[model samples]
Target: MNKTVSLDEIPYSPDSCERFEALRELPGAAFLDSSYPHSSSGRYDIMCAQPVACPEQPALAATETAWQQYFDELRRFHKDYYGTVQPASQDIPFCGGLLGALGYDGGNSLNQVSGAPPATRNSGGHLAAYNWAVVQDHLLQRAVMVAQPSMREADRNDVLSRLRSQRRVKHTEFQLGGKFESNFTESEYRSAFESVQSYIHAGDCYQVNLAQRFNAPFTGDPWTAYRQLRRTASAPFSAYLSFENNDVMMSLSPERFLSLHGNHVQTVPIKGTRPRYRDSGADRLAVEELKRSSKDRAENLMIVDLLRNDLGRSCIPGSIHVDALFEVQSFPTVHHLVSTISGELSPDRSAYELLRDSFPGGSITGAPKRRAMEIIAELEPDSREIYCGSVMYISADGRMDSNIAIRSLLCTDNDIRCWGGGGIVADSQWRQEYQETFDKVGKFLSVLEEMS
Candidate 1:
């Protein structure tokens, strides 16, 4: 059953980084900060820590049916609170959503995308798990501690007191090892780019997002690294998730895969990118260039069309439509052409059903999504566990929100793995596409070097 305990609002400064550090003492924490707070309804910044309940190490299912069953059970645990409270007439409350990372391999359960299985990877032993915890909403200036109905008042008070008494975090020195290693060499990536082109020419698929992974041995605090990443790339959909076995997922994603408010569902897909120039004049020119680029516009439009169809599977027929199109949004390192699409959920559909129809967001996959995923599985070597998948939350009221896990990192005890790539289209230049990957990951690499 849904249960909320009002707690004393902790003394928090508006500095997101410092606030995050203060809350780091909690185990199995999840922090989400929005870069563009003006775009959201007030509750954009949140920190959920100290899971009241979670799996020890949950394994990812191999099919959608299994995933569906898993989520159903998860939701059933907190159903009373899922969509029980609405802050406003049209707004969904900051109640609850599953907090975890969905790996790229999770796609297998959704559709028949053939590819090599992910390397025998070591990511805290579980692909995905959800948790319920004490959530602090920065915008609301309040903290809501969620617990099982049977939890004792003394135990609840102890959790609240700990959150209220968090100390300032100390800075730690991180050791950076040798140069980062890539799964694919430059020549190999070029060859793959050319191969994708060949497929496009053959009309196999319209577009596909191909990416490469980078890894480096490291010993330090992952939370510090996440703070540095956020400083460098303050994206609207940034998140940090810590698992039970000490594995952490850090994301500074600029794209939203999907969001649900009441019966209204929305998604904003980002398809085009251009590196931001240091000079103000040059930056303006770059933005203008991206705005007028036919290739970039066409690429974005195709994904827009694809997402409309994806939503159609779960939305009322006449309720789906594009809310915005071809709008260029600038970030610290790049400018992106993003489009927003919204629809009314069909009465029979649930959030899990919505995810079933739109897993591994179309923006990351190519047009004719299933076929492009098949090609992606054929070409990419490692399983995209978490990368290009999503960090999501589904509320009992059927409200949900998720981020395309780009500009993300998976941190284990000994090493950090990062991935970067872009869409390959018929007119995509091989050299540009190659550079785009670096442009996307440049901040991540730079922050690691600084911390090292």
Candidate 2:
């Protein structure tokens, strides 16, 4: 009923992006990238498209039961395709199931089961039950193409041929019309910061994340912009998703919201950040500063505790534990203090329930999630859309992984938008916090402008 073929004919390239370039033209093309030279946090690249079944919820089409309806559809798809499926071989992490984005609004709604006002804007989402995926396991130095159900031999041959073909597809080049413009000006951001401080002082919440959006006019292929961005902003959880509406979502997120393999679960939250510097000495100093900052450590601890409670809902009692805390991770443009928490999922729990119980990742939402979200909605000028959402894969074999979509860009209707933000706490300074947002996305904004 399933089909899988080794792609041994295709040469292994460290640059996974090159392998995905040709596949980008395929219908429903979606790439879950580990990038080239891969990050310490990632070891595989899963590229898939041509889903057998895919359910999508538009952002503007959200309702109280909208997220529930979408999940029901996803469950139906899984039951039909993956109810009796098997995982791919060669140590591949995914054998194909649900591959898509969950909108921020929708993810945020899950934790608001009681006494919360309806979301100002509902989250739109997508989950496709893909029968096949081209999986690259860098650690094993192997490549595999696995398809389930009826992938005819002819179809297999055609896909393999296209993959081995040279990368020469040309589309309109992506170029920004100008430098990006922010939704929050300096004064506006300052005012929001003061408001957050007021809430903290009033004991309304421990911390809240405030984000500002940036937009630039652009022309040409969205994939081109993603290609350019992956070189610099790429992280362990990076992804590029192409929609039929010609909408493109590019996520260079470094935060892992959740991962499930068998009954084991893990989540890594990133909280503290320091910008990268051109000078090696200055960069080292920044790393040391982040490692030593009491404010940063306290903020990280709050999110860790928040997630412990969230995961507890679906995890076996007393099985949850913090695997690591306050670990420093360096990326091309920033350094982060990341903490990992793991648990053994209750046998009665499904990955879907786990996701539902813990969506939109607490690191991005801050402590006391519901109240923090209320504060965010009151302050942020626009709906977050999919910016703080997730790009995930739930494999047929029951393995799952997702990224807290940050340092992300959404391109549509001749407009490109990206977001950057940080957690605000009692001790956080407004001006420095404002600049921190820029530090997170400075590379992405600058690179697009340079191309123009």
Candidate 3:
């Protein structure tokens, strides 16, 4: 196992111990926990990244060469386990880099974490970021996952209580910000129209997902906040993931990254969106409007087609099809038009290869995947990191599943940031697109403000 410890950086403490214990109870498991905290937010989250292949058996030898060999073996394991492989895509060259460099290599490890340098809060906003495709050269192909499936909620709660009791000072926390109804004042709508006109004229993109960040303070554990959001409004295939130090806590989302079972692979890409009214009747009307909106439907269809093409690359001959199209689904925040695409995998293929073919989902990137990605690189500020990318996991039996990393947070040593966006299309209104982003991030922002 690649155990990364930084004795000079931050010593392991009771909090880490509690999390480790909580996850250790699971069968055939491995753990990847982080301690990065969000500055000002004062919240840290711990993530149980993945489960090891064999928990009881003595681990494979640990040498530099051995590590490389282990990864090669894991690749085969994925192939044998999933029976399909992601196709090689020039669009996602960076997938390998992210996995190998930041994820598996010592890059993300604590031993390599400290004393090299310190970053100014938000100071690196202007720093040049690389595209995921380009970063592929830096990543390790296979990640080390620790699975501890036997840990119970009660056990975790006890550990939390113990840690809380041991704290010498009252801890700070985060809270929810309140909801907002933009109502699009008349002049504001006009401005939005103008923005769309400008975008159309520029030909920068046919569509853009617009959004706003909500600033708020949260008053307790970010993980608890995530649980509440999830429990209060659950979505099928929804996920709750935390990174070490609560730097990354996500209860996401309205999108699916990928799902594979018994040679059947599918992806549901959500695009078009509209707000839900608080009034029952109005909400119904709003949802109906969203379902029929030409702009929204068109956007959803485009993504569906994109997904079909992605699945086609890995599926058996004549096995690809669109299972669902333009279906409106309701989430806690908004209504979305989503489409599902599925295909029977080639018997010779494997899940790792399947993902290789379509890593960093197409929905977020847009049509002519590679071209769209290049556009995104020019437009977006930083590398998407986990945002827009998907969090993937494989079951012991080799069922592959992943979640699109939207409605998510990425934290380092001193800051936490979350990203949200909407798909833009030819007929899209810029202001409306912007509002969609706000609608998406509204809840998280409110909660953050509340905490503050």
Instruction: List, residue by residue over 329-422, the lDDT tens digit for candidate 2.
Output: 9998899999999999998888888887787789998879988988887888887877889999998767899999999888877889999999
Q: List RMSD in Å for every model shown.
A: 3.3, 2.6, 13.5
Q: Which parts of model 2 are misplaced by more than 4 Å?
A: 1-9, 38-41, 55-66, 113-122
Instruction: Encode model 3's per-residue lDDT on 1-452: one tens digit a residue.
Output: 22111111122342332333343333322221221121111112222323223211112122334433433455565344323323222222111111211121111111112221222222111111111111111122211111122334554444334333434433235444343233344465446445544654577545544322222323355554554444443444333433333344353555777877768898988887777778999999988898778888877777777778878878987888888888887876678788888898888776656765665576776654554544444344344454565555543234556656677654444344566677766776666766677677666655554444
Please name the candidate that would achieve the greatest lDDT relative to the true structure.
Answer: 2
For 150-261, candidate 1 gives per-residue lDDT tens digits of 4457756766666666575678766668667888899999998999999999988899899999989888888778777777777888888776568888888989998887
- Looking at model 2, how many pairs of residues clash? 1
Cα error, candidate 2, residue 86 (Å): 2.5
What does the lDDT read for residue 276 in candidate 3? 70
Off by over 4 Å in 3: 1-21, 24-74, 77-172, 175-220, 231-233, 242-246
* Model 3, CA-based lDDT: 0.47
Winning candidate number (TM-score): 2
Q: Which ten residues in a row have the lowest lDDT in candidate 3?
A: 127-136
What TM-score against the true fold does each predicted structure earn?
A: 0.89, 0.93, 0.61
Model 1 Cα shift for residue 399 (angstroms): 2.8
Compare candidates 1 and 2 on lDDT and give the better one.
2
